[model samples]
Target: MKHSGKVPDFQDFVECVEKANSGKINTKVLSIGDLFAWKDCTSKQNLKCRGEVPYARDMVKLTAERGITYLLYSTKYDEPCSKVLNFLQAMLMKNFPLP
Candidate 1:
């Protein structure tokens, strides 16, 4: 998987999920983004930030690829999930309700 830091590229993630769904591989769980800690994207000093939101075009592609499900986990309302959602909404206004 192509990755920057610990976060894998969103397109790569979609591809792996598709592969697993097609029975090409047996993957039960796939994790993306940060699971250990949250980093602010607006901060210029957080060079170790792991919250790289998927690209707008990549997010659109993910929606088009059926059979993929995702869950959001967060401890705070104004956290990484919100940032991710905001980024997705800004990128894919028409495809907000990802199938």
Candidate 2:
């Protein structure tokens, strides 16, 4: 993966997973941050940024569709914890509704 100081496209993330599943690459860990780092709000001026929403939704959709296991790690200092949690909950409910 190219670490060109830019977040990779969602397709890049899928390719990485495919490679790892096929044993073509050694990906020890994958985080939600790695996929949405491009949308990070680096400045307090943009604290209300919701740029990662669409990406997060897509990630959930793709993972559910492919029956892939996903792990999410959040740091208390990254952003508002409630927002992250709420987003995750909504995504999970929408993609994997509980009967």
Q: Which candidate is the best by lDDT?
A: 2
Write candidate 1's Cα lDDT for 30-67 as tens digits. Answer: 45543444333232323224465444453322222243
Candidate 2 C-alpha lDDT tens digits along 62-90 = 21224422333334444432233223333
In candidate 2, which residue ranges exceed 4 Å CA deviation?
A: 1-7, 23-99
Q: In every candidate, how many clashes are there? A: 0, 0
lDDT of each: 0.39, 0.42
**Model 1 misplacement above 4 A:** 1-7, 23-99
| Residue pairs with backbone atoms closer than 3 Å in model 2 (clashes) | none
Model 2 TM-score relative to the real fold: 0.17
Candidate 2 Cα deviation (angstroms), residue 80 = 28
Per-model TM values vs. the true structure: 0.17, 0.17
Which residue pairs clash within candidate 1? none
Worst 10 residues of 2 by lDDT: 60-69
